[model samples]
Target: MSGLFSSKRLRWFAAAIVILNGVFPALWILFTSLKTENELTQKPITYWPHEPTIGNFISAFQDQPLLTFLTNSLIVAGLSTLLSLFISALAAYAIARLRLRFRGLILTAIIGVSMFPLVTLMVPLFEIMRSLGLLNSYWALVLPYTVLNLPICTLMMVSFFQDIPRDIENAAMLDGCTRISALWRIVLPLAAPGVATAAILAFVNSWDEFLLALSMNSAVAYRTLPVGIQLYQGEFAFPWPIISAALVVAIVPIVVLIVIFQEKVVSGLTSGGLKG
Candidate 1:
């Protein structure tokens, strides 16, 4: 009985540590956002705000075109995620169901493509976008973001699609549904968790990407939230509170997305692991 009790206590302790590790940094940033600039610079550093104010948030908006940045990010990230999912879904389904030769090699190549350092591709991508007249446009970010997200998204979907029994899709096809139609109406519905998981991941990656957004969409009109946040820092000054506020605001969409799809994300992650 004592051994069992000790084991349970250890497990609880580990879980608490894991939760705190993840949650504490965000909480610290939230706390920092509410503090006054003077309070932030004071000695011994306060854990919470001495005087909470929304001034930092207001300044964040006024000092830069924050809303415009957010809009650009939304458009870029949304388009990227949609394109990634669409292309990945078709590719994954084919790989999962079709008896295509060298499918394993194909998946390996996909993974290999993703493994290339983003930095190495930047120069080539820049030239390509410039030549195509895509620079400073949504496509500049959207197309690259989609390519970056495709490999992992496709791999994840393949696992989920493979796990689903073929009989279900076979039945649909016999009832006059084409393979594409059956995928749309049948297999996809059953793989909702995987779809949700891939979407959130692709969205988060595109949302937080800074280098591509900074380089490809240098125009003020097309800058994303990550690039726009850098505008807050001057040569001699860093408004930590205002910057923290922007950080908090930047994360709201991602937080909300995860919350809404938490169940599917959890199920998808766990079930994907269970696949052979």
Candidate 2:
């Protein structure tokens, strides 16, 4: 009883520390966005603003098309995530259930594609995009993000699928359900956590991706939030207040996602823990 109590206390303390560490940086940026420029540039930076203002927030949109960036981000990330999740679910289902030769090798190969350095592929990806007229379009970012994120999403769904007993699938088949139907009806329903996990991760990666987004879209109209943040910089100095305000705006979608899908992520990660 004493040992269990101590273990629970330690876990709670560790969780608190982790939560604080994650939230602290965001809080600092939020605070800085409210501070006057002079206070931010002070010898000893102020922890709390003496007079908080919404000017930075106002300037973020006024100075540039921040809303356009946000919209582009949403379109690219949303489409890429949806496509990646759908394809990953199909691929993961096959890998988990199909009696294909070299199954392990195929999985490893997919993961290997992910491990290929992003930089090395950039030049080829750029040329391909230009050849296909994908440059300066959302498809440029969306396609690359979906491809890059597939392996991780596949692995995630695979783990969740593996946790489900084979008997459930067989039972569904015995009930006259086709293999595809069994997957769609039985397996997928049981793997909601994995689906949510893959979707969230794919969305976040596409939303935050910088290199592809930067190189793919030369037009301001197609620029994403991460690259759009750079538009505030100049030869003279960085606009710290405006950048901080942009970051605060940028944080909202991510925060909302985590809040909505936090449980699914946690469950997907721990999906197979009880199984073997």
Number of the top candidate by lDDT? 1
Q: Rate the local accuracy (lDDT) of all candidates.
A: 0.95, 0.91
Worst 10 residues of 1 by lDDT: 267-276
RMSD of candidates 1 onward, in order: 1.4, 2.5
Q: Can you write out model 2's per-residue Cα lDDT over 141-169, one digit (the tens) per residue?
A: 88988889999999888888887899999
How do the predictions measure up, each by TM-score? 0.96, 0.91
lDDT of 1 at 8: 100
Score candidate 1 by TM-score against the native.
0.96
- Across 1-276, the per-residue lDDT of candidate 1 in tens digits comes to 999999999999999999999899999989999999999999998998879999999999999999999999999999999999999999999999999999989999998998999999999999999999999999999999999999999999999999899999999999999999999999889999999999999999999999999999878999999999999999999999999999999999999999999999999998887874
